[model samples]
Target: MVDAVARLLRRGLPVTLAAVDPVLLELRGVLARAVDPGDEASRIAALDGTLRGLLARFPDARYAAAARALFGLPPATPGMNLTARRALAAERAGHEVHHFRKRVEPRLIATLTAELLADADRFTHAPLIAPRLAPVSARQPVLADPFAWEVAEQEEQLSLLWSAIYAARAELLAVERLISLRAERTDIVRAAVTAAWRWAGARAEAISYTTAFAPDLTIDELVALAGWTPPLTPGQTSRLTEAAAGGVAREQFVAHLHGETVLDDTWTTGLLAALQSTEPTSPEQPGAGGSSTAVPADPDQNG
Candidate 1:
C-alpha cells in the first residue's frame, strides 16, 4: 500500500491519479470510498483538495517544504527535475541529500499516507446520537393551531445562530481573500484562517455544552470535551469567550491581520454584542445558546 501510494503521489496531479496502472487499484478504491464514486474527475478533485487541506494544517515548516519538494504541487515548481527536487528538499529539511533520502523522506510519506486515509474515513463516518423526546404537555397543539407543535425536546435556533456566525465569518472571509493580494504576507493569511477555525470550534463547543443538558449545565462537562488529540487547545473555552468584548486576543490578532496597525474591534465585537442582546429572557435552545454562551460583549459594555 505504501509503495502504491508513493507511486500515485509521484504522479501528483489529479488528472493522473487513476488506476491505469494495476498498482494504483488499491489507492483508487480508497479514493472511491472517500468521495463521489461515479465521477472520476470529482473523485480525483476531492483527493487533491484533501491533500492540500492536510498540507496547509501541518504545523512544521519543514514538512510543508518537503511535501512541496517531493510532489510537484502548489508552492513547488512542478516542472523541476529530479536532482533539483532532491537538492531543494535537502536544503529545506536541513540535511544532506543522503540523510534526507535515507530517513526523512520515508517517514514524511508515511505520515502523509496516514493522514489521507484518515480523511477518507472521516468523510465516510459520522457518530450517531439518540434524539431526546419532548414532554407530553409541550406537544399539545397551540390555541390558534389545533394540530401544530414540535416533537423534539430541544430547539436549537439555527437561524439566529447561523446569522451571528455568518456576520462574524464575513470579516474573516475578507481577510482570507487577502491571501490572493500581492501585499498580504503568508503568516498573516495563516493567522486569519486560524482565528476563523477557532471561531468554528467555539460554535461547536457552545452547541455541545448547551444541549448536553435540557435540564441544566456545568463548566466541568465542557472542559472534558476537547482533548490534546484535537488540533485546538483544551483550555480555549475561556479565551474564546473573551474575543467577544474586544478582548486583547482578538484585538492583537486583528491588529496583526492588519499588518501591525491596531484598529478598533467594534466591527466584530459590536456585531457579536448585537447578536447576544437579542437573546430571549428565558433559557433558549442550543446552537445560539442563551446569551451566556455568546461571544463576549464589547469591552465598553462591561465598564
Candidate 2:
C-alpha cells in the first residue's frame, strides 16, 4: 500500500495529491480498527514501514522545491526602479511560500507519522495496562496490576492515534488553501507592476515635453510648467539648471516662442491696436476743404 502511494505521488504530486489523500484516510480508518494491545508491536511496525516507503518516494527536497515554485517567485532581473519595487514585493511573497513549504508542512507530516508509529510501541510494551486501585506514595512500596495497566495504556494509544489522523487531514486541507493563495498573490503583484509601468510611461512623456519646451520659458515659468504641485526641492532645482544649460535647438526654440506669442490673445490684441492707431490718416483734397471758423477764449475758460 505504501509503495502504491509512493508511486502515485512520484508520478506527479500536483495531480496525485488529491488521489493519494483519500487512500491515506482509508488506511487511517483501517489502522484504527486493527489496533490491539497484544498485537501493537507488529501494527506499529507495519504502519512505520508504509509511511517510510511513502516518504522515500516523495523525497523532502523534491516536494519542497515543487511547493516553493507553486508559491510563485519574483522576476530575477529587475531592470528599472519600478521593476525593482515589483521584485521586492514578489520576494516578500516568496518568503511566505518558503515558510509553509520548507518549515511548516514537513514538520506537520513528520510529527503525525511519528505519533502513529510511537503509539504502537507505547501500547504494546507498557509496564502497566491499567491504573491501580490505590495511589502509591513515595513512602509505600509500589504495587500495580499488569493486566489493568495494559488496558489503560492501550486506551490512551487509541486516543492519540485518532488525534494524529485528524491533525494530518487538517494539514492536507491547509496545503490546498496555500496553493490557491499563491496564485492570488502572483496576480496581485503582476497587476501592481502593470500599473507602475503605465504611470512611468506617462511621466516619460511629461519629461520629454518639458525638455523640449523649457528654452521658450523663463526659469520661473519653466518651473511652473513642470506641473509639479509641490515646490521643487534644492536638488531638483539644481537639476533643472543643469538641464537648461544643455539648451534647445535654435529652430525648435524659435518655433515654440512663435507659438507662445500667437497664443497670447491679450498681447496680440494690444499690439494690433497700437499699429493701427499709428498709421497716417489720408490727406483731405483742397477742393473738398471748407473755410475754418475760430472762437475767442473767455477769461473764465483755461486755454
Candidate number of the best lDDT = 1
Cα-based lDDT at residue 112, candidate 1: 75
Model 2's number of clashes is 10
Tens-place lDDT digits, model 1, residues 134-247: 357655434454233331222333332334344445545444444334322334334343444345444554454356533254433332222111133434433344443232
Clashing pairs in 1: 245-297
Error of 1 at 189 (Å): 15
Question: Where in model 1 is the C-alpha error above 4 Å?
Answer: 18-35, 128-303
Candidate 2 lDDT score relative to the true structure: 0.34
| lDDT agreement of model 1 with the native | 0.46
List where candidate 2 sits over 4 angstroms from the true fold: 1-32, 35-95, 126-303
Tell me the deviation in Å of residue 89 in model 1: 1.2
**Total clashing residue pairs per candidate?**
1, 10
